[model samples]
Target: MLESLKFFILRFDRRRRFFRTLAPAQRILDIGCGTGKNVTEIQRLFPSLEFHGVDLLQDSQVPPFVQYKRVDLEDGALPYPDEYFDAILVVHVLEHLHRPLRLGSEIHRVLKKGGRVYVETPNWISLFIPSLAVDRSQMQTINFFDDHTHVKPWSRQGLYAYLGACCHLEVEKVGTVRNWLRLPGDPFVILAGLVIPNRGNVASAIWNLTGWRIYGVGKKSTH
Candidate 1:
């Protein structure tokens, strides 16, 4: 029951909208596809597409649409042929690994020419919010670092530079999202920041200004 609730929340329609732009026949891979939440959504939105999921642990309840592989990305190689996938999803997984560059290169190795990769990670920008007195914690909430295996928390510049070095992928878009419910103090501040003229600028500024969270879609270069 708990896992079902998680699936519903994670499968937000807005998230699917971003992914549906990929071609329908493309083979999709989801790295660190915990409990197949994102994979299920992808299957629902693009049922005809081939979908594969990999994670450190295997769960019996993974949806029928997903082929599951159990492998520790931190300790071993991705067990697949080169250029195997047409697109890959790495949602909220990179920060938990020590070898992000190695994982990026592996993802590049598995992606066919002109393939796309969608990645989302917690924004290290949230740290800046506390510095600006917009939040109470001097750092991100406990959940941000709760994973014992997490090696690094990446800033936008850090993540982009790291991925760029491993593959010919270019960041096509960059954005932020709020993960926590706003409180009275910070909520009003965030609201005022949005209402101010040049709302995009305000939002971007606040987003970039803090160590919140960053997400991006990148297209693998064909050259």
Candidate 2:
């Protein structure tokens, strides 16, 4: 559709960077997998790797090859042995947790030695980002607290510490999450919003322009 084309040209997607962080692993676990977008994306990117997913609810959308478990991230433990996964993804999951560190501990417990874990969440800037839409109900959330599910926000430094101190993982970061190939479209998207703002796309594009998300890659220590 025409709208879909506009969204692609406008909205910034961070999947490419996240995928690169997970590329080195053979076995991957996605915490808070939701309805299996992570599973589908990973499968499309690297079909040879083993994939597992855990979520608060059941998902029927995933392929047969994926191992899935339903878990309450705060109440129930991640039911995997220590150092089990080669790479783990906690994309947009931590902000929803009441006890995020509990999951972080489990992430460290399940991740293989020297294996990578990629965590992405909204930064403090998410608290103030305004939606471009005139009718607010039509817009996807631009502010972090707009999603009542989000318990807290994460900064680049805070995420770095969360992985290092709580999880005992060696952490790495590059500040904000962005894709160079798509970044050139940001200014045009911002300008387009003034005349013909696609509410959903413009909000997401604005967030990317403002660096609303913070992320880090942590590797479980070998010794």
Candidate 3:
């Protein structure tokens, strides 16, 4: 239920931004496509489009529209030839990668000219919750390694720099996913905080902080 809710809130925004460049792609590849959820969601939005997914596990319960393959991206190259895919999606996958740059290069090579890559990863800065009076390093460490497979968290700037450099892709947008739920009750929280010193700022800042998850879309350089 929680995962589904997260997906529901995130899906529309992502879909809107991602498909802005290529509304209807000829062929798309999804790297690290665990269960092909992204692919399934995208296929629903664009039913006629061709979708392919590559992940370490082959037991994904993917829909008929998606062609699923098992590939260890950290060890081997992407199976497709250069400039084959019209677009690619790499959602929530980078942190688990041991060789993310290599995958980025492969993504660059596989995408057709002007193709776009959409990526979302956990934001390291969000791990530090100042309001809760948590230790920064310890909190960061906990969040960073919450998933045992995660190599490291990526800051928004770092993600842009690495992907841009590795793929020569033009960055479209890079920002954190604001906590939408926190927005509505901020004024009340602020009011309450005035009675209690340092409470308002802490309450309001939670929503104002743009550090939950960093996401961006980049287009392959045509030249």
Candidate 4:
């Protein structure tokens, strides 16, 4: 329920900006597409483009335009031919895997030459202060580690290095989001000290402090 609500609140456009940079007619693959939320948004945004979604859990609600496949991304190969997709969306999913590099290599294999891939992961470096100040009980309620089935947390530099080692992809962009308060002291501590008790205030503080999340777009080398 919370996950669904979060998806709706984030809206599709906020996440699709990188993907929309490509020309129309590019085939897109969405890995770890939970509940088909983003897939539906993409369909509405690009009606003519082809979209494919894959996940371990099969949800009947998958959008009509999105062809959902049940598969474990941690396994050997993605169930698709080489150069099957021109663009891939991996929003907040790479952090959950045990072997992300292997999966990245597979993503590289399946993408067409000059294809683009957008990847996102929680900014662990940004979460340091917040995770420390917030009580574990409160933190657990927030599900910071729940959906984070990921084996290890990631930093922008760490992710770029790993992806670069796995494949000949260029790191186009790297930055954080959701932080807005720009406070001097620990934003989480300051947020926890607020009187009115703004829920989003903490998130904004984290973003300002740590760049909350890290996103990057990479293009497969044509060579």
Q: Which candidate comes out best when scored by lDDT?
A: 2
TM-score of 3: 0.74
lDDT of 2 at 138: 68
Q: Give, for candidate 4, the lowest lDDT window spanning 10 residues.
A: 135-144
How high is the CA lDDT of each candidate model? 0.67, 0.77, 0.71, 0.68
Q: Estimate each model's TM-score.
A: 0.70, 0.85, 0.74, 0.74
Per-residue accuracy of model 1 over 39-58 as CA lDDT, tens digit each: 77667677788889889775
Q: Write the per-residue lDDT of candidate 3 for residues 1-223, one digit (tens) a residue.
A: 9798756655445444575445658898988877777777667678788889888775646566778778897874899888999998888788887778888788888999988888888788645643343333333222445446778778989889976898679998888766565556555655564556454254334534445577878898888
Better of 2 and 4 by TM-score: 2
Clashing pairs in 3: none
Residue pairs clashing, model 1:
123-212, 123-213, 124-211, 125-210, 125-211, 125-212, 126-211, 126-212
> With candidate 4 superimposed using the best TM-score fit, by how many Å does residue 185's alpha carbon deviate from the native?
18
Candidate 2's error at 74, in angstroms?
A: 1.8
- Report the Cα lDDT for candidate 3: 0.71
Q: What local lDDT does model 1 show for residue 196?
A: 53
